[model samples]
Target chain A: MSQLTPVATTWVNGQVADNLPVTDRGLAYGDGLFETLRASHGSLPLLSLHLERLQRGCSALRIPFQGERIEAELNMAASVVGDGVVKLVLTRGSGQRGYAMPVDAVPTRILAISPLPVYPADRRDGIRLYSCATRLSDQPLLAGIKHLNRLDQVLARSEWQDPAFAEGLVCDQQGQVIECTMSNLFARVDGQWVTPDLGRCGVQGVMREYLLARLVERGEPAAVSRLGLGALHEADQVLCCNSLIGVWPVVRLGDRVWQVGDETRLLQSLAEQVYQ
Target chain B: MSQLTPVATTWVNGQVADNLPVTDRGLAYGDGLFETLRASHGSLPLLSLHLERLQRGCSALRIPFQGERIEAELNMAASVVGDGVVKLVLTRGSGQRGYAMPVDAVPTRILAISPLPVYPADRRDGIRLYSCATRLSDQPLLAGIKHLNRLDQVLARSEWQDPAFAEGLVCDQQGQVIECTMSNLFARVDGQWVTPDLGRCGVQGVMREYLLARLVERGEPAAVSRLGLGALHEADQVLCCNSLIGVWPVVRLGDRVWQVGDETRLLQSLAEQVYQ
Candidate 1:
């Protein structure tokens, strides 16, 4: 229980609380969405992007989104945390036993702040990835949303326990590299930087979106296409990105190794600015 | 929230509580399994079958099972609620933020009882099913277990609001009829009783397992095979079964219709005895 006390402060539905009702649909049926943002200097740098995705998830799942209230809460939590991580979990709220949607649903909002995880300082330079056996199921309707139905990710993350591997790489049923267990993947294959298309599966990570937008602004948008595991192995450089970790260039995977490329360094430089 | 007050009693890990810690892995990543058993005369008639499935689910998900503690808590709750539905949710307990399995997870067991729902008495005679647009994803790793990651069923159940439809028929990605939103399907096609194989998707209901075991004992084992919508439409009779609902004779689906056949009535009689 002591190890679980990593959360610095918590708020539930605008009130400070560390417990949710047993009947919350999020815990019952995973009927919810979530956003994990990096807090820096009493502010969430990518709050707008995370909120945009949260709103889209709420719309798709038909859970009422409280945009203004959520924004206010995030800002308040960010101020308290100062420099850490803020996680927002919005659920369809408490419902009677069954799958049917409750008409007068009062959505549950959980906001928690935790000290930023201290990773190896050299992780930014390079990190190794474990190839996970768990395959991401293709559900187009739920694709790209940071929904609470994340057992797939949980299962994948459980495949490895070695500290050497910072994360695990996962693929779909057809062996198409989807994304890492915790981060979105980008690989420079044949001189073109590409990220997996998440229309079929995988969460459209906030940092991945930020990077793509940054690339577009510089008129060198990365290609969003399917990359097979074999092609990924032959790639010049591979990298994984997420809000918390910023970006980690892949230096070793199985039997292959690669030095960080110039483009990866550029991406890392941009990430450093946002995470500063 | 009055409708949500249907629960008669609630117990958390043998103690009466309606709230759980916000950091529970069950709410965080849906890292848990659940069982919904029917309570009759201060006892669960199919407790053994339910526990068997629970043990199997926990083993598959790697969540430690406290068999005796759970059984004791279930019995205690059943005695209190007598004739009703008892839901048991077992989670990997609280953990530090992330998907990694906690080394010393104290599994959370939530046992809740609700009064028997007052459905139309004539519903046992016949019921209609909605054809849901939501397709179950093919995740072999998670197939046939009633895990907390049930957004697919939640989405399917939300497709219709018609009270006339007792349940919804869902299929896999390849259009193979899997099961109903909340029950297991059994149909007699070409004079052969068959239920969809849940190797790729859907929950394997306790009632379905019990019925199959009974059939095997009687030397008339039902074949578990892949069923498509087209073949299902031409079936002689269609039925759905669950612990609480017993067995429901599906009388209508889309333009197709069926009658409460002799075999269905026989199964219903068996169910009546268990639920009596």
Candidate 2:
């Protein structure tokens, strides 16, 4: 673990610990939801957006939402995290040996700050993506929410260790493109920016939602729909977006290569202005 | 959370700590494997079996499994427990942001002992089961292994709050009976013991494997195959098995009552002899 540094600092519940308790439901059963935010100059770019998604996930998981308490903690962590990543983990707290949840559950809130990842400038120009063999399982109940059950992502990410492959685009069981391993995907098809629907599977990305809302507010031709894997190849350009890494254009996916297109450039520039 | 009593003692990475490091991957991404073993009289009844399964899970997840190191720690933990449940959690230790695993990954070993849960005497005779609305997603890669991704089970168990319903029988998206929330399921159909295949979803319980093996050795008629939801209702008897709950005859599943059969009695007696 020496090659990569962990959290710069961490707060468990409200205080620092040697680590979290071994019995924490998050660690025990992956019973939790998390948000990874981009922090710059001691400020979170999309803090509220991330919190909104987390709130939705908490509500879906039936965990009591303490929005004000979370925001207070977020502000404290954001102050120290200047130009880094702030990861917030909310777990169903500790539990006994059974799968049944406790009645009076005190949700454990974990906030951690890590140094910002430095990627090559060329990556923003375009990144090669691997078509992962690990397909996203369809489960409407867990779909769209960034829950802790991320083994599918782990397996998909592990498909290729080659740094040449910056990321992996995965599909559902029926060959429908869901999303990339880490980011939400968008492809310009028939002169419209179309993104995969996260109704059955995939994380309802914060950046994806932000851009969709932005597109709608600005009256841009874009859609969130079921996209087949073949549709991606037929599309004019493919773009991946996430809060951590604003937007990445897909230059190549295996043999299919895409030049930095007009629409992709427009979105990329918009990302920079939005970040600013 | 306060109502549920935590482990009697815990060992994190060979040393006792106030809690686990907040950055551990198990808590962060649910990148871990765990085993809940039955320890009695300062000894684990299924220590080797649990280790075998954990090793398989580690191999599948590409995490280096340290068998001797884990065994040493388990023995040390088991010695102090006397009689209870021993939970061993192995995680791909702390790392920087991103799903790409660290090169110098040091797997964290957590050993915890919790008091044995006291089940009702009538549970052995038969238990009522709730047919959960939460259907298990089909993910062949994660099937059968007791990895930390258990939100499906958590959701299924949460379907019913009534204490009268001891467990819930969950089906996959294909309407095939998978397993109980925390235990493996079996039914005597056509006078033969059969279990739902774990090829798609569901944890392969240690007790279930043990009984299957015992049946094979004794020349008993038992097989693991596809079991649809309708098959459970048409079965002669239903049984639930887990390391913690040895063997529970499931007499009722949502008004579909079943009488205790010869196969269920034989299995119960065998479980007692095995535990002895």
Candidate 3:
């Protein structure tokens, strides 16, 4: 028999509850945005980065953002979570059965905490990536923001179930590599770090943003390039990152093989200094 | 100063409840499907067509299809609504915080009934269509099925607020006319019927399917063509159709104007016989 797992504790609109009204537009039409944060020692290290993305998403979608109230709730949840993951879902709330915005709409905020995921011990050193057949749709309007309409990512993630493949590598319709199912990708091509351009498709991760900023601060800025599979295969090193899993070096993808290079280690150490 | 409107009656998993567990994948990632049906005289006329599409969607998404149970629930909801609308939402249900499908996901079914929406009397004669700036993303994996990841439609619908424009015309990123915000489009160009090809994007509506079949039965099948705005401008007649709205002839789009043509009348009559 399987052991009982610790259930997630959730709050809806600052009230402790585990259910949402079925009419909430988040479920009705995926009219919402979400942020997944890592809580460390009762504090969120990159709270500002997450909020910036959330604020941008809300503004783009025309949803009212109550930042002060949301931050207060997030702080409370982070204190309870200590060293786990905190997810925030903001929806346009319930509306009449229509696509038009409700004039008097109140936004719904859901904050929850779940136990930290356990990964293979060696996964930190390197992981294999599965090439997903599900290509990312090129909609610049919805690109680079973490929104609730993520069925594309869901479908890509579903393509592989083997534990050996840590994540799936996704591409756009034009066969250009975009990002992984749940992380952003970076490649070291010809001694220069290059990450895929997310202007057309892909969710921009906070960790990727932080790393890019850090790289810039150190005077070794990474280029945002349009990378195809050929460029990825020819790269000296490959790495993937997100808020949850700071950085994981990709050692193998199909016939291509890579060693955890010095650049990868340096980025991992930088992430460790902050995440730890 | 405002009169109270009749609230929708909802049933979740066969129970009279209006809330769902917050962990549902549908709310988390929009991993679900939905159908909006028009009920008349205590019955759903287009039930079979809706289910056929739902079945195809569930199969494509790897979700379990509980056909009989859903049919029963739809019947119950239709009886209560009598002459209104019935909406069904089927989600992959609650899951752990990840994109990977839970091995044993119990699908969640939500059935609700609301009063019929009322439009202007002149809307039936013709309505203007706003050319939306929001372009549909091209993803064949999620195309042609009414999956719940509909943020594109939500954004397109939000573009215009003019009462004169009843719906918005959405095109794909390639500048091909796809569909309206909430309905499928058909145009008569050079004495031949043409509809936008949905192999790349746009939802394949049940009403669209019904009309296509009806046209085929009359030996005048609509061509599934890749129609650009140029072709649309040259069309003799343009029509939009959905389950609730039945059929509406487009009267105007910007500088271009159209009258209710004879072909549009034929399709309207076909929809009327069943919807009435």
Model 3 over residues A164-194: C-alpha lDDT tens digits?
A: 9999999999999999999999999998899
Choose 1 or 2, whichever is better by lDDT. Answer: 1
Better of 1 and 2 by DockQ: 1
User: What is the per-residue lDDT of model 1 for residues B1-276, given as tens digits with 9 covering 90 to 100?
Assistant: 122223448877777789999999899988899999889998999999999999989988999988997888787777778898889999999998898898899999988998888889888999999999999988999998889999998899999998999999999988899999999999998887899999989999999999998888888889999998888999999899999888899999988888899999988777778877
Q: What DockQ class does candidate 3 belong to?
A: high
Task: Residues A1-276, candidate 1: write the lDDT tens digits.
Answer: 122222448878877789999999999999999998899998999999999999999998999989998998898888888899899999999999999989999999998998899999999999999999999987888999999988899899999899999999999988899999999999998888899999889999999999999999999889999999899999999999999999899999999998998999999999889967
DockQ of each: 0.81, 0.69, 0.80
lDDT of each: 0.90, 0.84, 0.90
> How well is each residue in B154-256 modelled by candidate 3, as lDDT tens digits?
9999998889999999999998999999999999998888999999899998889889999999999999989999999999999999988888999999999
Tens digits of lDDT, candidate 2, B37-91:
8877878877788888998899878899999989877876777777877788899
Candidate 1 Cα outliers beyond 4 Å, as residue runs = A1-8, B1-8
Tell me which residue pairs clash in candidate 3: none
The residue ranges of model 2 lying beyond 4 angstroms of the native Cα positions read: A1-8, B1-8
Alpha-carbon error at A196 in model 1, in Å? 0.5
Q: Native contacts retained per candidate?
A: 0.80, 0.80, 0.84
True contacts kept of 3: 0.84
